[model samples]
Target: MSLNTIDIVVFIAYVLGLIGVAIYVSREKAGHEKDANDYFLAGNSLPWWAVGASLIAANISAEQIIGMSGSGFKIGLAIASYEWMAAITLMIIGKYCLPIFLEKKIYTMPQFLEQRFDSRVRVTMAVFWLGVYVLVNLTAILWLGALAINTITGVDLMAGMIFLGLFSVAYSLYGGLKAVAFTDIIQVVLLIFGGLFLSYTALDLIGQGNGIVAGFAALTDQAPEKFDMILAKDHPHYIDLPGLSVLVGGMWIMNLSYWGFNQYIIQRTLAAKSLEEGQKGIAFAAFLKLLMPVIVVLPGIAAVILLPELERADQAYPQLMNLMPVGLKGLVFAALVAAIVSSLASMTNSIATIFTMDLYKSDAKPRSEQHYVTVGRIVSFSALVIAMLVAKPLLGQFDQAFQYIQEFTGFFTPGIVVLFISGMFWKKTTANAGLAAAIGSFVLSIVFKYAWPTLPFMDRVGIVFLSCLAIAVVVSLFENKVQDNAVDLDGVSFKTTAGFNVSTVAVIAILIAFYSAWW
Candidate 1:
């Protein structure tokens, strides 16, 4: 792949524009004190639109753009269950989980655990999350983004990683969550527009310059086998996405843990101005979720039809970009960059928030608000450096980086979800039970991975979640039932505005229609 002068100019302009936005947003406003809330939570002032766009921007990274498209090339439309299921998951979390989290006034997910269980559980989980973010999530995003850039522009992979890190840190470290969230609005637009353009072009090329509908028809007619939303037991990739199980089984565990409990994904919702706004924003994000497969997944399906001889599935995305005209290639490249940098900023901000609020503030004595904010910036910068250093080498270990990410993260999700769900609604859940379940879930994950290697990862996750939930229940039965000290939700109204209700209904209706048509 090569870039012309027009492409180079567009790419440079995009980078400069992002830098300008970051500096502008991070500038100190008069009378607005720089404190923990202001820095970490955006002063709890993010309105519905920013929250919704930032949530989508933060969630869709190179993982989706590069990795998921790879999966689409390899496994077809079934892979999109991750995105489609997440729409329902977000609605469920917004309806049931957000009220409790907001009422507790908690800054981090681990902090909520501390309130519901004990300090030991909080610290243990916090450390676990920090490791996953730095070692797995952040590293994966950087590595994949660097791979894409290197493939398209011929830049060295390490140089690409460093450049991305500096660009993300430039604004995020100073402006904090506010800057990250607000700038995400633009990032989301670029990502959507560029992604759509790429998909359209890929389809048009496949369809011999016909419209998208004809291109899509050609795709299905040429590779009819690729359109299945559910897979058969004997299908080559069935282990990854088994039929019926995807609809009713372990996929739910994955979706719930990610959408409801993940720190980076939910942090924007936590920063919303009010519960009503947050719920509405989440509903809007659910609507956007419906369109992701069109942008991210369709191009890969088209790739399978157009570039069938490519050796690697991961090359599907960059190979498609190679076909775009010079100016459009630059625009699409900027979109991919936007996806990578926005996610990097969001993760950096989140890691900083969790460490500063959950660990440092509690472990050390309380200091001035400004002091904590300073520490957050330092943590953000350090985490980025560590991730950049490890990303390339760590990602080299896997043949398919996307599947590797899902399976590795699967090790922790079952336990975390079991802990949160049981602790939230079940008043009898004891701290001892929470601690035991957490430790037991990790052990079970290892046992399943090594001892029963043939078992599907999704099935393993489902089994672990149930086993841990049972253990918690059995242990609680033996111990004295703890009094309910969960966050009081009496003051937080579950009543959503009419717009939110209608939008949510529309999202659900669309999801049902999609599955019905595709399945």
Candidate 2:
């Protein structure tokens, strides 16, 4: 696609502005000697609003916006279960999960495991997280970002991949989490605006033939099959086993692991000024989650209704951009770029944190702040290059990049979730049990993913999590619980009960809404 003059101009100007944000943030971090906490956790000084915005931006990347909408086009609204299911997951984390981490003042999820179990468990979990962090999450994100940029700019995928990889790496390495958060606020705003504009234009196109409500009504009536949540065995439009399983079993595992234990998303919470801020920031993110269907998913349905015969699902989102007027196209294009960059910065910074804290200095006494920060930058750049290499192969397999990432997530997350949740409040969970649970669940999930192709994905995840929990519990009962001389739970408490109240409402509301919407 040849971008006109206005599109070219808007794209360049937006890239420049983000580069400027990166430069300013890098200077801020450079001014101080960044301690371990300062570099990894943003010095624990972020305000509630910035944390909230960063959380949303970090979580909603080009993959979710662009790739998820592509899923919507293929699978209809059932694809939206991922977003809605996350509301409940966030509430759980904000209540049961966040306070424990906050009170402990831990830098990474693995650090919590170490305190709750043993250093061996911590190190093992760290290796698991690092592998997923680099190979699955970061790689898929970079690939899709490059895909979106390539679609808009007429550049080759490799070239687009390299450009974005370098640009995000430069700032993320220099400034640490502080830079990521500040720039994320800007990225979120642009992404929302861009989505709104694209949705409006798509609606307008539908309006040209029929009024807004009528257009949607007409589309809905014409292909009721598209809106059906259940798949028939024979029909392409049917929500087959893969589709249904993803909704039922797959989403829960992904959301819980991601919100509860993943370092990147949870890092925003760690940066909050207080536990209250963190809880509130999470609530804000939940509210935003409700809007995702409007911004990303609904347009995809509309695209399918309008352009049903398109050869590929990945083409749906970019094709929607083409429907906009020239100037509006430029603006929407810029917004997509912002979403890509925001996600890149978050991942790059988080990868650096994991490497520096968990692996590089795992046993060493705390190093000087400057030394850690300098090392963080180098790690970020290295990760970016790795992601670029992975992008090409990933994009080739899945019609939409989002599903490709989710499929791989099944391999690691279920076990990690089982290990962390059990380890956190379950005192009887010994370090050996924690390790066994994680490794065992991972093995079970891999078995389901590859060995048993006939089984549904969600069934596999449920089985893996259950198997791990059972093993961990049984092993802990038989073996002596590894007692850490320094193990203490008091360090991780959030004295106020604000999260409980909010979480109660969120859980009930999500349950009612989820069942009611489909029922």
Most TM-score-accurate candidate: 1
Model 2 lDDT per residue over 233-333, tens place: 56453322245554566567778998889898999999899988888888777777777776887788888766788777876787788777787788888
Candidate 2 worst ten-residue window by lDDT = 237-246
List candidate 1 segments past 4 Å from native.
489-492
Global lDDT scores for all candidate models = 0.88, 0.75
For model 2 the TM-score comes to 0.92
Candidate 2: how many backbone clashes? 6
Record all residue pairs in model 2 with backbone atoms less than 3 Å apart, i.e. clashing. Answer: 34-369, 103-491, 103-492, 104-492, 231-238, 231-239
Q: Which digits, one per residue and each the tens of the lDDT, describe model 1 over residues 1-519? A: 678889989988998888788779777778766899988889899999999999999989988889999999999999989899888888889989998888888789998999988888889999999999999999999998988888898899899999899989876789999999999988999999999999999888877888888888899999988899988888899989978778888999999998999999899998999998899889889989889998888888889988999777887898899899989899999999899999999999999989988889954466989999999999999999999898878896565688889998888888888889988878788888888888888899999989998888898889999999999989888997655665455655677678877877887888788789889
Clashes of each: 0, 6
**C-alpha TM-score for every candidate:** 0.97, 0.92
